[model samples]
Target: MGKSQKKRQMRRHNPVRVPDSHLPKGLEAASSSSSRKEAILPILQKMESVDPAERKWACVAVSNLIQNDPSTRRLLQGKNAVGALINRLSDSEEEVVVEAAGSLRNLCIDGGFDICAEMYNKNILTPLKSFIPKISTTLSEYLENPKTAPENAQKLVYEFADNVITILWCLSETSNKAMNAINQISLVPFLMSFLASRERLPISTVTSAAQCLYVLTDENPPAIEEVRSNAPYSACVLSIVQSREGLPQANGKNKEVADNRGLALQVLCCGILRNVSPIPPPSVAATVDVDRDIVMPTLEPVLSLISLVEASQHAQEHIAKEDAIPALEKLSLKHTPKSDHKTPSGLELERLEHKLRTVQLALEILTGVCATLPEPDFDVQDADGEATDADGDEAHEDEDMDDEPEVDMAPDNEAAVKQQSGSNATIFQTLVAPLLTLIQPTPLSFPPLNGPSPHPPTTSALSAIHVSALECLNNIFLSFRGAKIDAPRADPDSGRRIWDSVWQALGAVGTDIDNPGQERRRATWEIGVGVLWGVAEAHVKVLMQLCDAATDEGVKVKCIGTLECLAQHPGSVDANRVCTYFSQRVPEPLLQAVSALIDIYSDETLPYDTNFRQGRFLDALVGSVEGVRKAVRGIDRKKERELRVRGEEVRDNLVAFIEYRRSLGV
Candidate 1:
């Protein structure tokens, strides 16, 4: 054939060129070369075909392509594959519907919050609301007569239920409208049915249901009330948490995998329990059966998850380091390769990520408990009229020279001391210390270039953990009335250790603390002279630094609030002195911090999608700034006047915003 004819023939033999309209904007030029996305265009087109079998096949293909494949999910999403699959949910074919829902479910997992939000915006919930009752009815039929359908058909029904429930659950996480729709459909009881009959259902189906219920009940009053009112549902979730009966049976190597799955389910159940029940007051805690049976049991599994994740990371780091060493070095050390010392597989990494998420959720729940649990009513004063320490009265001779002498536990209050120790032990061991660990960064072993690197816990994930831990500690501090220690020579300390650790954990990001030689005064001071300053002085520096440097609004809010709290409530004589130190040492401390907060509160560029959330955050900033203004009164009278004037301006602006939002009925 002639060259021109051969070129035309080759063009015909070449893959059919996808139209520019099918590709995401700006990718039209690259479409001729057949991008990863264009490769899937035919499948997407087939999803819209008149043939039901082709549509079903296309949907299944999309599901399989996106399953555990985040990169492909993103490509497909950019190509409007999500919209196509969402449209397929309302397709005439049953198999098409199932495959479409399955694809959406995987997108929710692999694509995470952004895709879930996209799906919600595309009105996925409208179809999902319809699917909920249908799936529920299908499952009901299966439960009523399992043998009526062929076994494969029965499995399909379960798959459909699982996929739909999971998509609903994932969507509920992203938007309030989706959550309300889910609640309107009475999804809570349907979810509980799966958990109630977990053994009879596929583990995937049961786990998906449990996870959906977990999300629905968090801060969702209707769903919470539904679970609360149903004794069997409550008992079933609590039992799963306590016994881990939902964990699949496995032997040898598979046991570890089974345990991870079981523990994950347990964490979800614990989260569900946490949502439905409030922490009982200390007076009722000892007597409340629910507290004893459900709430207390939740902590162990959560703590175990934290420990497991940490242990796995350490093992991985060790293996990575050993493998990184030179062969000559290994020979010199007489090292032998460990058969099991392999890099974490994708599945293991996914499990680790899940465990970290569970840790964050668990910490948040504990934070709620800390915030709501009532203060102990016991009197600190003994017969002699001297107050006692709650954290114990052990004296440290090596304590900083500026430290106050430790008080002796009140003599004749042996019973109180015992009770106090028991409670303190539990809180510190289970909650406080773990929060501290999570707040600190996980260390990574340095891997050689061109060598396989260890998959360390991500900074963003660890940062999330840090924020959660900080919030929990904040609650602990607030709930306990700001850490009152009546012991002798206590040195006016408040969150000294916590602030120091947090500062280090943050790596002092967005700060100048890491400048050369600044490490000597990393947190506070040296042993002599200025070291005599109370912990309040040191903590003020850390909080102010963090407040100024933090980008996360939540972190900034916590720091600003904590600074104000410390200024208002001086814990000791040294703390009182250090409270004044904020005025004396830090130049216009409250002024800068409050001004930053006000700026954040009023920034139109960073406006929240909902006025309510904006207003609430602004309200928090207002309270915090006002407290700091009252306590520190700026660097001096002159600076104080400036702060007051600025505050007046902020107040006016805030009032106007509130009125505007109120007028709109938001």
Candidate 2:
């Protein structure tokens, strides 16, 4: 009795521990602690349970565990959790299928190429595709009794459809292989159908469908062509862009949700347009007539939205500036200014950012179309009055160059149609006008230091609005560079105005300084320099101003670099016009700025290494100074003398700095 009692007590006190060898192959490696593995292994096992209820619960648990946590997701992947999930996608219980799909969707978030490749190899799309018809059927049935259908049922259907499309989106984004696989399944038409029937689908489904299309078509020419080939796709996109049925209200209680939904739809539409109308310079040679017709209608809504956002932002700033109490009045009447008057609401900022993105996408579409259009051809005649080819061949020699059937060098019919549609006018009024307004300086002065700053600045770094605007402006100028147009008499002034805004935006009150916190300033400076460089001939004055007025070393260096680029390579700018402008307008300020830069480099008091800084700033400066020296040699002998003298001084200073550094073994 004593031996039996002792044995029984010992057994009760020490429970048996399972060995790692007995567990699934990779389960032990999923987590560091044995106890954690023990906890998770049961759920993994239960996922394979014969009972559908247990499997459904397991799927939900796994889904939640991996939803937002990357480490847990990686661990699950290591444990072969994907194979289990894929198996459950075909589960007879609808709940299990939905949960498994949700789980897979979460895993695909930022999953990287390897995980996505594995999922693709597992034929994840087959199960995902299978769920579409099932969800569609359920949705159709639910629409019959929309008011009476249970909320859970509606949520389940929407979530399921969202998950399926989201998984497909992630897969398509992973690599070319996955995209091709998706393309083979006719995914574009599938998603386009969902987008077109927005009345029947939930907002979530419609958004996901659009997002899926966006991913599928992005940089995928064949997929884009597929979408372009679909007869109803462009109309569907235009419909979504124009629809106001479910738009966000300004003061609504669910403003954030409504705003997000609107933004999603807009972004999706823009993305489709962007892909279908490829941006230029890596020109898409294969033309799609569908995209040609879509350019203006797609832009109409986007540009209008941008104008509204710009107006609202202006109004908000106006209110913030005007609402302040004067300092003397505050002392006399003992009134305090409202603290909350300056900060914009989160929803307002989100809406503005969304609109900025739409504007960027719209500009991208315009840029693409402009790229597709033929450049204005100019005939070159020899001094002897004989026409020559680009290679300097005589007209008869050009005929011998390519004997293949002479392809029409004339502008395509699409270009003629675009002109007839007055797209250029619409673009100038809609896109260029509003963008110029954004960069234009306001009349309000900065308030006194003791008072709050008038026009409170946005707290965001590198605001999407400013960046997108700058990028769009750059693309417009670049695309139109050298292209002849029959634009109105004011068009040349429009170009000058663009230059004025760019200069003002780049060198505005807060931007000239070198503050790390002022990230937007840097972005503005970079993009502004790019735009000016694009239209260097027209903006020669702006370039001169940048070289003279810029105080930041980086800005100084970049401006010099841009001048060098202009002088060395005029790009699409008329070389004769550039030479004329530089000869007439740029020599004096350009030399002054260069002389100042030499003095700055020669200064010995600064703590930084001159040699190190020189490496960064000298090449561009030398190139620019020398370029100016060469350009004005004959036209302006006096200016040429001044440039040579300043340039020699800079070169001597730079050489002296290098020699001194080397002597010190620095």
Top-TM-score candidate index: 1
Q: Each model's number of backbone clashes? A: 3, 0
Worst 10 residues of 1 by lDDT: 1-10
In candidate 1, the residue pairs with backbone N, CA or C atoms under 3 Å apart (3 or more residues apart, or in different chains) clash, namely 404-489, 405-488, 405-489
RMSD of 1: 18.8
List lDDT for all candidates, in order.
0.53, 0.53
Can you write out model 1's per-residue Cα lDDT over 550-634, one digit (the tens) per residue? 7775676566556545443312222222232233322234444444333332433221212223224334443454455455443
Q: Candidate 2: where is the Cα deviation over 4 Å?
A: 1-84, 107-115, 133-151, 214-426, 433-469, 484-529, 535-537, 541-565, 569-577, 580-666
lDDT of 2 by residue, 1-666 (tens): 000011111110001110011122443443652323443576689889998877876676665554323345556777778889999999999878887887777566434455667898888988877766776677667767787678888877788888888788778766767777777777776677678677776766788888778767766777787766654676567566556444333333333343455555754675576567543222322233434444454444444443433445554655554422222223211232221122244335434434444444444444444444444344555434566543335577565667777678467866775674464455556667666655433332222223222222222211434544566666555444434432322466777677677787666535443442233456566766777665554454465567568777567556555554554432332332223333232334454344444443343433222222323344345446455555445345475677566556654554564455446432
What is the TM-score (0 to 1) of candidate 1? 0.56
lDDT of 1 at 391: 23
lDDT of 2 at 634: 38
